[model samples]
Target chain A: MTNDHHIRTRLRDKIVGIAGCGGLGSNCAVALARVGVGRLVIADFDKVEVSNLNRQYFFADQVGMPKVTALRTNIHRIDKDIMVDSHELILNPDNIPEVFNDCDVIVEAFDSAEMKLMIVETVTEKMPGKPLVCGVGLAGWGENNDIGMKVFDNVYICGDHLREVSPDFPPIAPRVGIVANMEANQVLEILLGKMNDGNNTQ
Target chain B: MEITLNNRKETIPDGDITVADLIRFKNFTFRLLVTKVNGRLVKKEARDQVYIREGDDVTVLHLISGG
Candidate 1:
């Protein structure tokens, strides 16, 4: 393997806090671990359900496990040296301050609209300058609508925007994968300060 | 008067309205979350009262999923 000292030196010691450890969060966390993110704080108040086995990295044995714990197990399986701090509670007004305190960036990965808004509002109110890259509109069907990318300052929104217009696509794996990768790419860009807000890839 | 849904422009009567009012007028089901406006995601509590001005662009999204 080529010694990619640049990525290692840059990603080393950078702290990323993920708010939801479901499809997008779990995938992103694993990808970041592979690349060499110094520390990852994974928080999810949800437990693994039988349905999460499809796209998420959790195993069949971890079907009833807390998502954070399952995600930690998955990440360790990939890279045992990667440091992961698992929080077994939902992100809310009370504990958000400490959850985001040392994070260099925040990844919003919840599936519920309410939770997504909560984390965004909490971060905006508490840490305005901290950048957040989030995923949205990835539900439903069709490859044409499942991909989109946009960036604004520290905020990047990904996924499909068809919930209102097209009432067909239900949130699924293909949709989630395309959007999740977009989010992970944004995280890498932001970490390296290579993101230009004007770029919109849809 | 005109309004924009997501981003595409559309015709509408000229009036001051909140996002919730417009969404309700369209008979939209209250399910997907509205995270950012013009670029910022908003809290659920503020969604009802968030005022929409002329020529403003809004992006709404959800954060939860099983996968």
Candidate 2:
């Protein structure tokens, strides 16, 4: 197949499940839709707030709306042809397989440390064969440039080294966008089997 | 000398190396976000002058919230 055909065929009908429809999740959903990932499964139990307006793509009208629903709306607005399954709930062991069984990749976007760790550990255990890319530190205003992925076989963590001494940084969309897109790209690379260097490449 | 990292137990040279000294050696500046240490949470002011032991576990977690 030609290079163009190869790329298209690689992405066609691929299913990616995104956990957390906040900044990282929302932006990743949009990026995947634009990239023609075919179907997307996005989940989040929260809603957009006024504080999220600074960096999130959602508008004031969507402030009270469930993040999953709003993300579904955003994806639909971007590409109606894309199939998105939106879940307004948290991801846990009980539903991980059911929610992500058909997914080619899983994107973790939980904001809280405990939640992120829980999701990461649970997903890693439940779906050892599937690929996962988690979003990590995109904190601070002017100091968020290091975006990369840590690939351990099929599990990947994107962002910066998440240690307490790291810093008290804030989230910005442009910065989040960079890491989210990189996560999405890593998903694509995994699908293409070009993810051999997934770990240190970040 | 050894310094604690993310709370994971590591054997390092015993000395007065502070957490700041360890972070600098890693080429990590003062802007990255850290969330947890040794599987526990750490505050901002404790980033420096936190004396580490040879076998102490030090975990560093960054604050990551989406846009």
Best by DockQ: 1
**What are the per-residue Cα lDDT tens digits for candidate 2 across A20-130?**
887778887888888778899988888889988867768889989998888888888987988889888877778878988899889887766666666655665567657
TM-scores, each model vs. reference: 0.74, 0.69
Candidate number 1, chain A TM-score? 0.88
- In candidate 2 the C-alpha lDDT for residue A196 amounts to 56
Q: Which regions of candidate 1 fall more than 4 Å away from where they truly are? A: A1-3, A144-146, A164-168, A195-202, B1-67
Where is model 2 more than 4 Å wrong at Cα? A1-6, A163-168, A195-202, B1-67
**lDDT (CA) for every model shown?**
0.73, 0.69
DockQ of each: 0.27, 0.17
State the displacement of the C-alpha of residue A119, model 1, in Å, after optimal TM-score superposition: 0.8
